[model samples]
Target: MANKKRQTEFLLMLDKYQGTIMKLCLVYTDRHPENVKDLYQEIVCNLWESYPRIRRKNNIPTWVYRVALYTAYTHQRSRKRSVPFIDLDDGFFETVASDSGNEMVERLYSLIDRLEPEDRTLLFLYIDNVSQVRIAEILDTTESAINHRIKRLKQKLKKMNENEEEQ
Candidate 1:
């Protein structure tokens, strides 16, 4: 029965946050459906491994974010060296097109892909309105450090945008 209860909790958590995981996977995998699906499964497996330790409070997403992002980062690094880029079908683009007003969001994600992985996590949390202090806790850094890094990231993004416009 203990195992059953844990499964129930895990399923509930999965149902609630799978979209976020998918989005994170999309970010890390560059919208490649095959890679995104693989990352999603991997993140779910990692979350299940840690599920018994997870708290169900409002901070559930915080813990999930840490696990998901770390898994994405590790997966990216491991695959970066040898993964061949086969041409993917544009099925994901079809979904994007059906969702109105998401073209800018897609373009923003492209810009974000240029950032360092650590900066990407920070930007993801900040854009989602996670408090700097909470982001510090999630990322195992100081609140002031999070703030400073975010400031630097903003300047970097701004400069990139300026340079792009000049072209």
Candidate 2:
């Protein structure tokens, strides 16, 4: 009975957060449908393995993000791959750095695909509307550090846009 109850609870959790996990997988895998499937499976297995610890946490969403991001990061590092080339239009960077929040947020994934693993995780959480406090918890960093990094991330994108214009 206890085992069955645990299984049911775990399923409920997975069902609730499946989209979030899948999106992270897609981003980490460069939106390759095949890789996304594999990564999604791997993330689920990791989540299940850590479910008990996860359930004990006050913020399940943060725990889920932490596990999913860490799993993606580890999976990415274990693979042997060359740097991927991402080609975008001239205006891509400009829009990313633009004042239009919805448009920028929608296009954020494109930029995420080209970032380092850590930066990608940060922006993924940011765009998901995760609070700075939650993000700090997820990344195991201070809130001020998350703030500083986000500022740097925006400036970096703006600089990239400026450089592209000069080219």
Best by lDDT: 1
Clashing pairs in 2: none
Worst lDDT 10-window in candidate 1: 92-101
Error of 2 at 29 (Å): 0.6
Would you list the clashing residue pairs of candidate 1? none
lDDT tens string, model 2, 17-39?
A: 98899778767875544456657
Give the per-residue lDDT digits (tens) of candidate 1, residues 87-130.
55657533632334668987877787888888888888888788
What are the lDDT scores of the predictions, listed in order? 0.80, 0.77
TM-score of every model versus the real structure: 0.84, 0.80
- Model 1: what TM-score? 0.84
Best by TM-score: 1
